[model samples]
Target chain A: MTNETGAPLLDVSGVTLRYKTPGALITATERVSFAVNRSDRFVLLGPSGCGKSTLLKAVGGYLKPSEGSITILGRKVMEPGPDRMMVFQEFDQLLPWKTVLENVMFPLLDARNLSRKEAEEKARHYIDKVSLTRALHSYPHTLSGGMKQRVAIARGMAMEPDILLMDEPFAALDALTRRTCQDELLQLWEETRFTVMFVTHSINEAIKIGNRILLLSPHPGRVKAEVVDVDTASPTDGSAGQLEKEIHDMLFSQEEAH
Target chain B: MSSKARIVMRPLEDAGSGEVERELSFLEKAWDNSGVRKVAIILALALIWELYGRWTDNALLFPPLSDTFAALIDNIRSGVLPARAWTSLKILLMGYAAGIVMAGILTIAAINTRLGSDFLETMTAMLSPLPAIALLPLALLWFGLGNGSLVFILIHSVLWPVALNTHSGFRAVSTTLRMVGRNYGLKGFAFIRKILIPAAFPSILAGLKIGWAFAWRTLVAAELVFGVSSGQGGLGWFIFENRNLLEIPSVFAGLLTVILIGLIVENLIFRTIERRTVLRWGLQS
Candidate 1:
């Protein structure tokens, strides 16, 4: 699970994302570098608009870095591919027209060289795994908020991507629902051992779900700190709340320093 | 207290609570029954209209609801209204279908290329403000007093709104949805079919509503001026001929039929479809 073999499951090096403005360029993230091993739950922790999601987008191939490069499974990613699936923040990520099962089967239709029967089988498998077997025929609109995210998660997992990138996927749900989904996600990860790069603002969520957390500074986001805690499985019941608060204070100390 | 007294008091209290709960449940059920409520309202309005129309003395001003219904029945039995209605429906469907198809192609093209979008915007801006009825004289000259002329006018009525709404709908689709589409590696028609079309459906339905109204009005006006097409007269022709003969009640009959059809189409067909699709999906309230 190291890059010593000259290959990593996910790799990002010297990545900078900038927006070109009329008078000057606005940088969102600068000099970001990390490599994720196989089955690693890597979390990018930052406040809103800190370019954490932007970095996820960069890895997902939705956006290209202004500088540096990204590679997955030793292949340089210049464009979005089915091999790197993204679970978006919005629940509408699952197409409303599709039933839950169909939504999960969508990528297989486009990405894989599988038959319809094969795709359906695989989709049902993932749907069942997400505890959505009863909702297989239900449309996204009929599902509750937590249910919608479960469908999206099932859709991404069914794609069997080398790396799954989530852009604050549970942020919009209610607190209780978010916690439930967080635990479900952790359980799913334990079962599948899928490589995941999750972006979140909540330090509590980051510590609970991530094996390693990368702290990003606000406004022209940059790497502030990186902590690898291999101690706990996901969905920590506030046991690590003190450690998370410490990280939160350190990251937000800009206001205090000023 | 005596055991007999306690038994009577407890039973009486339970009965009272049960009755109140039952009434509350009924009210709750009624609150949830929106579809039933809507139907009831429509029926009540129709009844009121019928009663009012019958009470009116002037046949020229307000033909009794019975008279309108009887006239509609007579025309249908005589094969007059059906033939004419069929003709109108044919032209309407043809021109409407063609307009929608062309608009869809144009919107897709517009989304893909900057030049196409620019051209579409300019063309829609130029045409949308100009009434479709205004194009009749030119259409008559070009297509020469037939179904072709009516179709040309119909196209003028239907095209711009569909194209404009579709283009905007495509533009309005959230980037997140688009990214999800791309993540699946869908390109070209596949992407549009799976993502753009469904995401843009609400706006497209609105465009369809506008297009239908525009086409309906334009068809009637065109037929009034042009008379008939391919020797087959439609509802518009029936109205025009009745007016020329100064048959006021018959003209009222034709007008009433038109209004009825419009209402039926709007409330029953289009709205039903909208409810089952966008509204049911919770994409639209």
Candidate 2:
């Protein structure tokens, strides 16, 4: 069964992702490598043209790697499964027809084989964790962008997946709301300690959210370096600002070299 | 103008608690009612019809509104109109249901495969614009002189619009939503039923409406033609008979019946569905 107790929860080794355009085939990621241990807050930090999101999608099993492999719990990723739940950046990720409660319960019922009552109870718990119990019945369209993201988070988290893939989830929010969401996410992480692979371009966000960060260079993304122990950075200690500056320089120097 | 201007700062005046609500005037209230407005418009049209018919003074050509109403009541009393209406409705439903099922199958196939999509697109382009009645002669020759012929034409009328709208609706579903569905391990028919159907419902409903309208008109026209060679038929046949017997008011009554049925289906059935699904879902205002 190749069951290794010490195997990383997610092991993405030299993975390459190629996608088709109208007239061309483009490599989105080239030999990008990273490993996420159990309960690791892994962040993929890069510029807009970088394939961080694409890499995350590959790990989510939405996109198959053209080269190398992504193994989760010693099993190769073949396709999207409940084990790797993804929360997309777009607010439209939440089903417009389903209320917040139903959105959270959908996967619980579909993949987890939960009864309706069980699903509802689990959904409510997650909704409460996201502080959205009052908005349980609200449709996605009626909610603010921040609220929609929370519902999406609740939906993803409720699945109790092995890993959660977040593709710049709070990127579209206003700065203030983005900060609040980031804080809420960290608080939620503190409670559940679930592993998450967050992809974002914001250096500050990467520093704030990631305990382990993998920096990728843009235009067919390639891994530049890995920053470990980001959790040591705190606002009071000024390490957060130092780490933010370090990330900025890393990206800037890589861009200059390119 | 001076480079530096003097600035004045003052405390803001206290605005009254707030203007929370206002009572609408009678005219505004009445005008705000969609049903009232539609009824008024219908009454106005009836008034115009009566005035025009009376001025023409040619009952054989154009019956007045009151005479048409009387004919409608008389036909109902005799049970002929209801019987004819039922016959037409029953046939229409049979064709409509068949068309919906076919459209659903085709659209689902199209979503699942590239070749199926091309097939749907090509078939819709070729057949959708070709008037369904234009195929009635061919339908008649193939199916013989009966409900079969009418049903074939009705199917042709209903199938294309439903397929086109539903296919396009399925296509228009957002990539993010599709990913979310798949992220939950939803695939095949489960993916379609859970994600695609609801996401594309507004477009699907629109297609249904267009198909119904086309089917209804085609049914009436096909019936009128059928009366030329066949025995008994629906409202169209009633109108044809009334015209042959020089009962002009009864013809008007038959025409009125068709319009009323269309209105009822559109307003009651479709509107109710729209309110319950898409409107409540905030897909449409």
Candidate 3:
């Protein structure tokens, strides 16, 4: 699926997003652009105030860019569709009334128009992948935070979307749980090599998960730099630490300059 | 030189290592059982009522609890009380069902569109505060001494609170759940059935309960008015007739029957529903 000449799977060209509150029109991102190729672990990295999440939402078709365009496989993104599944950060993202199996099968039944048996089969398969097969009948509130995220991921993965858009999915988890969840996500990716566009503020996470990273500036986010060839750099070695430090310095230097 | 005087302070051994479990005493266990406690309270109240009624020596106003019980048993054995209760319950069910249906429609509309929500708010605001019994005269004039008048007032009593509570519940459904529904391409009725209903079920259950209570009370009140001239009447009519005939014990029996029915429906019917739904879903304790 690696292509140097063909059009990227997801194309975000000069997109800007703005939202309105009761009084102010807040510009979340401005002229942010990136392309995600098939099977790419593309990460959007930025500081707290930056609009990486907003950008991801725009790509997910939940938010429309105030200016510019986002296209998925040459089709203009207009609204939230099953083709762009999202795994949110909140533990409450899973439907509390739905058992883990039902939560995973919901999108399959709704979007894929699968029969009940087929949906159940597909849902169970994904649940097994996330090691949540034992919790198939358990409700969301009964599950731990990590387990809920797994269910959410299984739900997203079960749909077999063109690209999964994850917005800081492990950010709310404890450190040990977060690490385990990150590892599980990578293992799932290794098995399926599914394309994912992940948004996070953690540099370590970006270095570990993303093959290609897009760094954005602070509030009213704009593209600052793109770090490529991340997969070739060994994560446990001195080079990974060197790269982390260098990116940290670049990000901070930009803030210092302002 | 003072090495012997130097003492070491060490942490307590096996601190927080395990939990202790103990068997409860008979009294403690009985106290823990809500059903047993409730029955105890009821028995105590009945004893107090019997004592007070005997001391006052006023059979016309406050009959002894024992007398009321005997009257209740006599009415039950004659099947008159059961027939009247069935009549009231039948009418209550009809009005309640209709009210619930109307509430469902109004709530669906209220959540879906701006104009629909405005309409619901306006109607509830206008009608909710106006007591259902207050409409009894108009209902009597329009429907004319029948179940129609009773049902009209009963529906009036049931509709507003159900609609208001359902709307509020629907509004309280989280935005993330709505987004999840939209993300799956669910819209219209599917959206409501899949996402909104379950998410807002606790509130909806509360609405149903409030509506049931309102409908029950309204049916009895309306029946009281209708029973005066009608050949056949419900429990309310029975109570009114007993009052007129100076059968105070029978009147107390009629009131006891009403209370019993209320308790049954609230505990058995509504509590069972709560146990199966909101409690099971962990939406409510």
Among these predictions, the greatest lDDT belongs to 2
Instruction: Give the winner by DockQ: 1 or 2.
Output: 2
Interface RMSD (Cα, Å) for model 2: 0.7
Better of 2 and 3 by lDDT: 2
Computed on alpha carbons, the lDDT of every model, listed in order, comes to 0.86, 0.92, 0.90
* Residue-level lDDT tens digits of model 3 in A93-204: 8888888998998889879999999999999999999999999999888999999999999999999999999999999999999999999999999999999999999999
Give per-residue CA lDDT, model 2, range B114-181, as digits (tens).
99999999999999999999998898889898889888888898999999999999999999989888
Error of 2 at B142 (Å): 1.0
For candidate 1, lDDT tens digit of each residue in B21-136?
33457767886799778878988876886788778766676666677777778877998887887898899989999899989988988999999999899999999999998988
TM-score of chain B of each: 0.83, 0.93, 0.92
Evaluate residue B57 in candidate 1 and report its C-alpha lDDT on the 0 to 100 scale.
Answer: 61
Runs of candidate 2 with Cα error greater than 4 angstroms are A1-5, B1-20, B228-231
Question: Candidate 3: where is the Cα deviation over 4 Å?
Answer: A1-5, B1-19, B228-230
TM-score of chain A of each: 0.93, 0.96, 0.97
Residue pairs clashing in model 3 are none
How high is each candidate's interface RMSD, in Å? Answer: 1.4, 0.7, 0.9
What C-alpha RMSD separates each model from the true structure? 5.6, 2.5, 3.2
